[model samples]
Target: MKLRELAHSRTGDKGNTLNVSVICHDARHYEHLRREVTAERVKAFLGDVVRGAVERYELPCIGAFNFVLCEALGGGVTRSLALDAHGKSLSSALMDLDIAAPD
Candidate 1:
């Protein structure tokens, strides 16, 4: 199953950093997402787009996970030449990540 089936995401950008938050539709599925979506996994999934470290912050209270991606914006909104420098589409792209169905 895709992550999108279980959660939705929001994105924010600061300079070359990108922040993505994944919030589960059902709180019960939080554990499953937590297990499947790791910083390493996210970095691998995003590939070359991310040039630095990936940090994962668990928000168990809200059944969410926040990922901080460094050097992902090509530079920064004002400095990047990329069309989607703000990385709004990044959250939507992340939703496509594949994960095992909740047990």
Candidate 2:
């Protein structure tokens, strides 16, 4: 199953960093997502687009996870030549992640 089936995401950017928040549709799925979505997994999935470290912050209270991706924007929005310099599309991309169906 795709992560999109269980959650949605929001994205923000600062300089070369990207922040992606994944929020579960159902709070009960939080633990499952926490187990499956790790900083290393996210970094690997994003590939070279993310040039720096990936950090995951658990938000159990809100059934969400916040991922901070460093050096991902090519540079800041003003400096980056990429069309999606703010990386808004990254949220959609992240939703494509594959995960085992919740038991």
Q: What is the lDDT of residue 100 in candidate 1?
A: 98
* Candidate 2 segments whose C-alpha is farther than 4 A from its true place: none
**Steric clash count of candidate 2:** 0
* Candidate 2 local distance difference test against the native: 0.94
lDDT of each: 0.95, 0.94
Report the number of backbone clashes for model 1: 0
lDDT by residue (8-83, candidate 1, tens digit) is 9999999999999999999999999999999999999999999999999999999999999999999999999999
Worst 10 residues of 1 by lDDT: 87-96
Predicted structure 2, TM vs. truth: 0.98
lDDT of 2 by residue, 1-103 (tens): 9999999999999999999999999999999999998999899988999999999999999999999999999987999999999999888998999999988
The candidate scoring highest on lDDT is 1
